[model samples]
Target: MAVLEGDCEDSVSDSAKSCQTQSCTNCGGDGSCNMNSVCNNGCLPGFYSLACAQSCGKCGGNGSCNRLSRFCDESSCLPRYFGPLCIQLCPLNCGGDGSCDFQTANCLQGCKSRFSGTRCELSVACPSSTCRDPCQSINGGICTSGCRSGYFGEICNRVCNCQNNGACVQDTGVCESISQTTSVTVPTKFSDGKTAYQRAPAEGDPNNYGS
Candidate 1:
């Protein structure tokens, strides 16, 4: 009888041990069947899994991440929205973060100044209405704002400082007139009985033979 009782106790002990092992394996050795451990706590709403690695659609406003389940709750603003479930307006432009003047989109400021064109895209302007020629000898030699060069005369044709006896050649420096010539004329006559012939003064002669 004593041996049978001892065997029965031993059998009961083995069964309890087996039950504990089964429970531990089912509960990950924590000894308690915690709902958090068994239930998919990490998964987002409408999602359930051992790993909780699934999407649950966009949370309406800012969502909160569950600490234990890592689930997103659509009860507030998102990170970029930065409010109670993402209900507030973004500080910068929601799309591009460009300048948002009075809630209306306009040209944003750019790196350069004095440019108001698209996307703040424009080059610097000339000082006046016109840009100067790159080849002028003197700075600002070419006139701007419709004031033209060569205005002193035709194509800048005004007389240069070169004066008296000096002639302005085309594109050449001034040149001066040099020598002058004078001439004298004398007359002589000869009668050939039929007519009288007169010879104009020969070069170096006061008169020819006066027959």
Candidate 2:
């Protein structure tokens, strides 16, 4: 009887040890076991592993990582950050007013009127004093507003020399003038419509009016 009781106690002790081993292994040490004995607690936010021991890659604290794959969740990236791991920053700060492409970092909208280039990093080249009326029809180095007085041509770099109160053509820089000439004529009138005849006897006279 003593031997039998001892064996029974030993058997109970072995059973308890087995139960504890099964309970601990159910969750693979990576998650908590639920009431149904199913592993459901999953790894922490940025960590993933069978035992929740590995850390997620650097996501600049802007996104969450997948528990199973340890990859960053792009949809959760911070405002200005983008890319697979949310590691890249949007370029040009969206040119101050526009937005940037989340994947390519390119500008979603065009730059402002005062700016140009793919990233809007370059300033629009407006005409200067040398070109006259810098803001008039500004287009790079070309002076579409036309040069100021005394200046002419596409760049407004050419000087003009108009003569005799002449003005230079804005497009060609050629001198132009507006001068005119006039003439006058006088007509003689006769007292009578018929011709007058002098007497032949008076031809020899020294005081003849016909002479």
Candidate 3:
């Protein structure tokens, strides 16, 4: 009877030791063991998993992850980075001097003059500095005041080449005589600067032979 009782006490001790070992194993090193012997307290910030072994991937090293889902938390991207995982770079790097949209990665401000487009990659051509007026086109090829003197054409790209001291037409750019001639007569002037003239008879003059 004494031997049977001792065997029963030993069996109880062995069973208790096994339960303790199992409970300790259930604690995943990240959390303490609960009353039910389950690893349930969750991992520390920026880490997640049953063992707290996984890091928040591409979170710019400054973001936290959801303990249960292991996904990056909202608005956790570092400066110049965006997207849910903080993997995408900000647009144009904020045009190198601007701010970026945290969600869309678009430029917020500080874009250079004549720079446009979503990323500020497209540029508007400036007018020619030599031109006296604004350019009709952004290419600086066509002038609003037309070309300067001695130049002509749609964009004043052509040079005046008229001969015989003629002036060019504004619209057609054609050369023509500067002055016109008439047939009317006037009194003649002598070398001494005296005026001389001869009067012609009218049809109704009294000395006319036909009358």
lDDT of 3 by residue, 1-211 (tens): 0011222242243443333232323223444543233445655556665545566665644456665676677665666666776667765524444545667766655344445556555564523342345444322234556545444555555555454323454456654432311122346567998776633333333332220
User: Candidate 2, residues 121-184: lDDT per residue as tens digits?
Assistant: 6575543464556533213345666666665666666765543323456688764432211111
lDDT (C-alpha) at residue 188 in model 1: 40
Best by lDDT: 3
Worst 10 residues of 1 by lDDT: 131-140
Question: How many clashes would you count in candidate 2?
Answer: 0
> For candidate 1, lDDT tens digit of each residue in 56-126?
33233333344344344544333224332223343332223333222222333322222323333333232
TM-score against truth, every candidate? 0.16, 0.31, 0.35
Number of the candidate with higher TM-score, 2 or 3: 3
| Ordering by TM-score | 3, 2, 1
Could you tell which candidate, 1 or 3, scores higher by TM-score? 3
Lowest summed lDDT window (length 10), candidate 2 = 1-10
